[model samples]
Target: MYEIFEQLLSERGVTPYRVAKETGITTATLTSWKQGKYTPKPEKLQKIADYFHVSLDYLMGKNSSLTTCPDCGFTYDPSYPEDIETHIEQHTAWEKAVKEFGEIYSDGVKCEQIKAENRKISHDLSLPLEERCEAQIRVLRCLFSRSLVANSYSLDHVPFDTYVAMMLNNPSYRKNNLEDDLLQALIDKYGTASGMNSGTIYHIPNKSKAISTKDKRDIKRDLDRIMEQLSNQEYGPAAYDGEELSPEAAELFRDELEIALKRLKLINKEKYNPHKNKK
Candidate 1:
């Protein structure tokens, strides 16, 4: 029993000082037990067993079986030699798998914590909107660059021109003219670049260029479409021809349309007067 206790301590690399501190057992009692001069009380034995995560019978030398299977929670008996070997092997594999899983779980927790911190930083309202947007763009660029590198591919292999062509050729992608213009500019700059290094690809010669005629026309077209849709809704199947809406529904729709029109006016003003708010 004393030898088994000593072996457990050795396996865990725990010194007597640590064992005494952790289990609240005295050094004198441990020394006496090691010398075969004293046996611990049942309560003390239980404390020691619990601390070392071993069964009391195993600690007391009454059970000289292999360690309990971590999977099945059963000790292997020598009486069934063949079964014992297989059980011990399975227990060993289970221990290794558990240790590996613990490491992976720890890494996953750290990654989630990092993502939360990044989200907080990215969405901070005090930062200028342009600064925040640029920061997010840089992060996205880094992620895409790293992904390409890890896959042993280059920008040439999956050219920005190809994506732009696909988007421009698809009517769904052309629905938002502002986004389409931005995508076109990006494709023009980086479509033929050898790699995805932002420093090399993002150096446009005319960063302050005005919105093109096509973009202006597209914006007007979108505004006209919105007004047409709202007009249709006002007199569509939901309403009676030449009949006014109920007062409540009329007020609700009026307020919503007013707000939407104000937003559209603001966007139009901003598009034409880009320097209006600049110092």
Candidate 2:
């Protein structure tokens, strides 16, 4: 027990004098503990564990395992070679599978959540038509941005201009009068004269600007104001004090705010100080 306790203290670069000073334990008690004169009481053991951010079982040399189970939250003894090896292999495999599944499940959940939010926005007759239209536009923009990222890795996918042209050429898309205007706007922005180009499509509304020091400061100020507005929005009666936007609007606000902040950070790295890499 003393060996393990001493080793832990050494690993943390904490001396007995510092522990005694910080934990309010007397030098006599620490000396007795180090000399193996007697086992510490539960209260004293708890204080030691709390001070060092370790388990009582670890301080007392009862259980040697350092890892806790993610599924069951149980700390298993890894003193035995075979038991520790099998436990590690099983834990690692389970965690890998769970991490992969979680990413796919999270993506599907986000899509479903967006669909539900749009339905709610459309059904709320209290909201003005313009507000509803804006909410839907924000949701579509977010979805389109995600699709662009997903298509970036695929080598066989056609250029974005070609995709837009294909959609515009489709008779079904043409039949939807409302969708035709939106698709036409996209074509005007991204499609080339010949209707085929390798140009990349950017989802952000504003193109890159000359990022001087003053420009970066202005961008930062705008980011701060957006964040403050988002944080001030309340869930109860006070919610009426601020702009009453739907969940989709809040999501779009946060996404755009993040993009602006990242752009500023990149500009600072590439333009302001070319020698240093971004942290």
Candidate 3:
């Protein structure tokens, strides 16, 4: 437990002295923990977990997930659930088949040769452990090669495994939108908010009303003297861009723009079927 704590602290770039200062624990006690001189109580362990924003299970090396679910704040367990075990086993078998496919796609290997090999392997659905392992190697290699192609096209790091997973999960969508140049541009123009935050839709006014008529009328009497003084003077704009935007207005506007763009693009893409005319 002490070793795990030390490792986690080091990984997060935390110093023992800094942790002691933050947690109100003495440096000597923290040092003792690192040296295996003392075991922390439950309360102390809880404090450590809170300070690092990590679960006690992670601190104790019992789980590997780095984040907790925002909705329930439940700590993520890296271990697969019992129900998903069968799915995982099936995926493992698929991986074995992919290995041989990868070998053929290697730089020196001919594409025709690899295609032939893949066809032969595909015919044999009842694969033994040895054949399955070979297939997986090829699949992994092919996936890596495909990701490399994406990386070369765009000067960005694309994880091979992530690409492969996406392809398997949504074959048609992945094929259609494999190398999306618009994604980064969209994220830059509008921000990328994930999960529930991304789902939120907000409304914006057609035109920004600096001050509503009622509010403006109420303030007119107060500013009557100043209004006369400034009546003749030409002011380019308000003190700070026509009155500072409210926090809610800014956040809602931000959310609205992103939601609108994403929604519109998806709708347009779905409605426009190029194959319809041909059919």
Q: lDDT per model, in order?
A: 0.50, 0.52, 0.44
**lDDT accuracy of residue 249 in candidate 1:** 61
Q: Which candidate achieves the best lDDT against the true structure?
A: 2
The TM-scores, one per candidate, come to 0.25, 0.27, 0.27
lDDT of 3: 0.44
Can you write out model 3's per-residue Cα lDDT over 30-56, one digit (the tens) per residue?
777777888677788777877776667
Query: How does model 2 score by TM-score?
Result: 0.27
Clashes of 1: 0
Candidate 2 Cα errors over 4 Å, as ranges: 65-279
- Regions of candidate 3 where Cα sits further than 4 Å from its true position: 64-279
The TM-score obtained by model 1 is 0.25
For candidate 2, the lDDT comes to 0.52
**lDDT tens digits, residues 1-279, model 1?**
888878888877888779888899999999998888999998999898878766677687785556554343334554333345445544454455334322111122343455455445545658655554444333333333333222222222233333334333444423422243344544454343222222212211122333332233344456556545554566563332445556566556556655665556556756766345443
